[model samples]
Target: MSAQKVLKLSDLKQDAAVRVVIDDIPIAVVLDSNGEVHAIGDTCTHGDISLSDGFVEGETLECWAHGSAFSLRTGRPLNLPAYEPVPVYEVTIDGDDILIDPHVTKEVN
Candidate 1:
């Protein structure tokens, strides 16, 4: 499972977010407040809402389903109703393309 696809770049805008699926995993690639591209699981652990549709603040992706925010880097659930952490994927920028590792480990602490 070493397939990689270019999604977007980091020189675009501050509120830029892209939703992509790789290796059958849904991921939301977003540029955080630190101007770094981060990848997180699209599904919210609190419910079944897509995190891509939620608000992304800093490195934490807020789940609109239950307001459960998860860290884009560590995938740690930071809100209520979602004690479980979502998955975070590795992101690499190739020129202007954002490559996301879809098969991320679901280990959250």
Candidate 2:
């Protein structure tokens, strides 16, 4: 499947996260502190919480419920309370739009 245009680049502010649904999957589109964009699974692995409601520290998104930190790039859980990694989607920046492919993910190692 092709990448779907999820959001406009201008709508996403720095150090903020937005929840978007594509292909029935909930995704969290984040603009980190370094001005880089990332797309990760919105659901926190440890708890039934939205990661977009959590905090963004650098490249990691912390779960608001249990404080599990997930890597934005690899989707690997960095902290405790969550051992499983969430899905990380491939993000494509097209002009002023943010495109995301839910089928593609960065390999977690």
Candidate 3:
């Protein structure tokens, strides 16, 4: 498993999202409202809008373009306009650093 260091924990604020690229993959690193970190595909499945540009409530990240809400843990769209789920990555926190494995995705059903 090739895991890359994405960002520092201090670089992300609580309840915010950041767009990152790793090995040509656009990822959305989200600091959820519960103070937990999650990593998922930045692109919305229904639209081309970036998920990082949307609002995050609890564990759901809403797409700003079409108001599609996706779950941070599973990448599954909880609302309409998007039936397909995005890719969810595995995040590892090492001390103050945040590591992400772009090749490794958390399976969502």
Q: Largest lDDT belongs to which candidate?
A: 3
For candidate 1, lDDT tens digit of each residue in 1-109? Answer: 6538756574446755567777667887888778888777788887888888888877788877688888887888887978887777777777787766576454544
For each candidate, what TM-score against the reference? 0.85, 0.95, 0.96
Point to the candidate with the largest TM-score: 3
How big is the positional error of residue 68 in model 2, measured in Å on the Cα after superposition?
A: 0.6
Model 3 accuracy (lDDT, Cα): 0.93
lDDT scores of the candidates, listed in order: 0.75, 0.92, 0.93
Off by over 4 Å in 1: 10-12, 104-109
Question: Model 2 over residues 51-106: C-alpha lDDT tens digits?
Answer: 99999998999998889999998999998999999998888999999999988887
lDDT of 3 by residue, 14-91 (tens): 888999999889999999878899999999999888999999999999999999999999999999999999999999
User: Runs in model 2 with CA error above 4 Å?
Assistant: none
- Show the colliding residue pairs in model 2: none
**Cα error of candidate 2 at position 89, Å:** 1.0
Ranking of models by TM-score:
3, 2, 1
All candidates: CA RMSD (Å): 2.3, 0.9, 0.9
lDDT of 3 at 51: 93
